[model samples]
Target: MTEVRSTPTQRVAPEEPPPSDPVAAAWTDYLAAARQLDGVRRGAATAAGEQARSVQAAREELTVVRARLAAQQSRLRERGVPAMALVPSPPEVTVAARSMAAGPAAVLTALRTARECADAADGVLDARGWVAVVGVWRASRPEGWPDRLRNLLVYGPLAVLGPVLQVVLVLTGSGARIALAVLLGLVLPAVAFAVGWVGVGRFFRPGPDGRLDRTPRFGVLVCGVPAALCTAGILVAVLTG
Candidate 1:
């Protein structure tokens, strides 16, 4: 009862500690700022590297595309296309530039697409060239001429050389010359066949690296038949005359 009427105890909240040193707080803030700045610098470096790589790749692709286009232009010119026709128009160039306005990445993509198109064009040109050559070959030869017949044409002239020489020697009325012609007939046909074989391989080849059916056995037959017949005929004439 002594304190029954005493005043209620006053409640006091605990005081917070004094503020930290100003220099330490400032140093902490400075560290955070430095870390942020370092992060920014790293991000900038990464972006710059990627951009540089894209630019370099675009340049390489452009070089390749230019070389391909130049070669194609030369080929087209040889095929009678005008140089002006091969050049890109101003509108096309403007459109291409607009397409790559976004960045070097876009430029690289455009160049790669152009390279693929150029490769396809090269394929088409090669096909057309092959067709043109084949057309010429077919037009020059007889209709429906097979490989054998075509090759025989090459060997025909060479095969007849021995017989022609024999005929000339017989006309000269020299027995020794006729005998020499007979000896030549044996050796000359082989030589002619060799020459014709090389000629056919060179002339009838389809492309720069293409091979054709040389038909060696057939060529031998074509070359030998004329010489054999001519030699037999000459022998008969010599014995009878």
Candidate 2:
């Protein structure tokens, strides 16, 4: 009976000190850093995009100015005034010194003095006037169908072959036609360049500062892209034929 006696034991409940954990604080800090990094990355990307757009905008502005200058020159030609007169003059002032020693009104002397003043004033006026004229001229020139088509016709092929002719010959062994293709290639782009220079001169106007008022990238693209496409077409036709 004594050997059958057993000892009774009490159980103590386990304690949890607090709900807030250090791990959670670390996680919060990590998330904050991640968010800040993301914000900085986004800001940089935005700035880069804006800068690209600004550059494109500036290019466009120059083209517009060129067009305006051309138009103004054309208009002046109609009025018998040289287009150059519309151009701004350098800002050098001319001084005419007069002496009272010439004596009492001296009708001949007065007439001479008057003429000199008039000539000086006219020169100043012409310089300023031309600047305005050129500005207007550039603004009004047209960039229409003919100009676009011409550029496409010329630059298209050259743009394509200018960079790829050698590659094609090495791969295809079409050496016989290579010279011909190259010739064709060079011609089209040369024509396009000439067209562009002339067309730009024809349409765009200048500003008061004698600068083109608008950018011509669109015009350039219009000509350039088409020429490229034309080249591709020609190449494809020749290859497949």
State the lDDT of candidate 2 residue by residue for 77-157, as single tens digits: 765987668665554211212332333333234444545654565576578789878877755444323444434443444
lDDT of model number 1: 0.85
How far does residue 29 in candidate 2 sit from its true spot (Å)? 1.2
Best by TM-score: 1
In TM-score terms, candidate 2 sits at: 0.26
lDDT of 1 by residue, 129-232 (tens): 89999989877763335678878778888888868887787779889887877777688788888988898877675533555766788878777777777778
Q: After superposition, how far is residue 97 of candidate 2 from its true place, in Å?
A: 36
Cα lDDT of all candidates, in order? Answer: 0.85, 0.56
Q: How much is 181 displaced in model 1, in angstroms?
A: 20
How many Å off is the CA of 54 in candidate 1?
A: 2.1
* Deviating ranges (above 4 Å) for candidate 2: 1-20, 77-85, 88-241
